[model samples]
Every structure is written in C-alpha cells, then in structure tokens.
Target: MTEAVHLATARVGDLAAVMRVMDAAFDPLFGEAWSGAQLLTLFALPSARVCLAWHGEEPCGFSAARIAGPESELLLLAVDPAWRGRGIGRLLLDDWQAWASAHGADDYFLEMRADNDAAHLYSRAGFVEVGRRAAYYRGNDGQMRDAITMRQRPSPKSGD
Candidate 1:
C-alpha cells in the first residue's frame, strides 16, 4: 500500500495487462470476469472507457465504464487480490466519476452480486442501493445469486 502506483487510460495494446489483473482479481466460480474479446469489443465502443493501474511495471488493477446521455454505468472495477485493501479500487472509482463528470454524466449506476464484499466499498463511496434483480447471476458453480443495483447522483454544488 505504501508503494507508488500509477493509473492511466488503457489502450487496446494494454489488453494483456488488463486481463492479467482481471484473471487474478475475479474468481472464475463467480463468472464475473470478461473475456479479452469482450473487452476488445468494449474498447471499440465510442462511449466506453477503460483505465489501468500499475504498481511500478506490474499491472495491478483496472476499471471500465460506459456512458449514455446523462448516465454512466460502471462495467467493472477490479484490483488484483494482492493489491486489495490498498485503495486501488477507490482510486479507480474516483477516476471513473471524474471522467464521467467531465463527459456530462449526472448519474452513475452499477450492479454486483448481492453478497459481494465490495458493496461496503461502494456504500462508502456514496452509492445507494436502488434496486435488485432476483437470481440474476448464474455462477459457474451453478449457484444463482441476486444482483444488487446501486446508483449515485452527483452531489449538488456547495452553494445550491
């Protein structure tokens, strides 16, 4: 956590690095991690964005999102397990919100397994539970999990 970490917008060439982190971050049993081809398609979208985080020369975390009109949806936010509890995920979320704000997004949305521990992180970041989809995710283990949808709206200006 004390080590210097760098984060930047990721290009297509950074796919390998991104996937490396994704592989280490997401457990396959949950079936949350996306394939490289899926990521490549997202990279080709006009409204999509990807950010990669590095610890020295090693890629450690990443975030991806897409914007549509005044809203943006967080597609992914992952930190290598070894790099977790060190604020990388928070940094990625902050970066995404900043980027979304710059692009005129007023509301943000994301969904995760109802039992995900990351829910605490999102709650701390000001995202509020908005809805739920019953048995939305079918895990590789054949277990079904509810999806919790969360939303965050831009804070009003100080004067307002």
Candidate 2:
C-alpha cells in the first residue's frame, strides 16, 4: 500500500470543502437532486463528527458520522477518484471508528443506494446488510432507487 495519508479531525471552517468532496462523490449516484447545502445540513447535526484526509496540503477524501447513544451512523464517506485504491478510505474509517469508540459508540451503521458499487467496500470492512428499503431514492432523472442498510458491531473490547 502507498504511504498512509494524514487524517485529522475536521474543523467547522472546513465545512464548505467537505461538502464539495461529498457533492463530487455522491452526485453520480444521486445526481443533481440533492444540493450541497442539503447534504451539509444533514451532516451538521450536533452528534456528527467529520474527518478530512489530506495528501500533503491537498484535500483528497472525507468521512462523516454521528454518534448517538450506543449507535453511530456513517453519514458519508468519499475519496477523490484520483486518490482511490490508496487505502485512504480505510484510513478514514479507522479514524472514524476510533472517534466513535471514544464517544461511546458500540455499533456502526450506514445506508447506501442498493445499486451503489461501493457497497463492496463496506462489506469488505465487515459491514453486514441488515435491511433494504425499496424505492427510497428519487434520482434526478425521476427514477426510483432502492436503499440498503448495513451495520457493523465493534468487538466488545475493541471499541472500549
């Protein structure tokens, strides 16, 4: 694997840049139906934690999640196409898991469009598909898409 890139906690001032990364990563799947502002609002909740990944000074990836009670939901995880396959996503996830563990989260969850090819990544990370919602996403083309919900439980001693 390439040298692991630097991963750090996201600051409030980084919202705009984070939104840009999310918009670029999700647009192909959701199309122009959702705006960056909407995405930001969804991730801006108090329980949310966002992390940014950088290769030197350039922003290359990001991931966001919310830890509430004993559960944490991964709202988004994206990497610049040019930076894919470099283990950046895994690094970002490792950071997120650590953050969630520190915040008392024992379970992690995420939802994705059923057709999303990146679902494999979640599977490879040990996330199991627990449920599916049909016709959950309305694409820009006005077509309906299904959503798959996945979850992962941290080892009892792992997160503590």
Highest TM-score among the candidates is held by which one? 1
Model 2 ranges with Cα > 4 A deviation: 1-4, 32-36, 39-46, 156-160
Please write out the lDDT profile of model 2 over residues 3-103, one tens digit for every residue.
75788777767777676676566666476334556556655677887799988877788887888898999877898777888888888887888888898
By lDDT, the best candidate is 1
RMSD of 1: 1.5
lDDT of each: 0.93, 0.80
lDDT of 1 by residue, 72-110 (tens): 999999999999999989999999999988999989999
lDDT of 1 at 62: 96
Model 2 Cα displacement at 155 (Å)? 2.8
Among all windows of 10 consecutive residues in model 2, the one with the lowest summed lDDT is: 29-38
Candidate 1 has an lDDT of 0.93
Off by over 4 Å in 1: 157-160
Pairs clashing in candidate 2? none
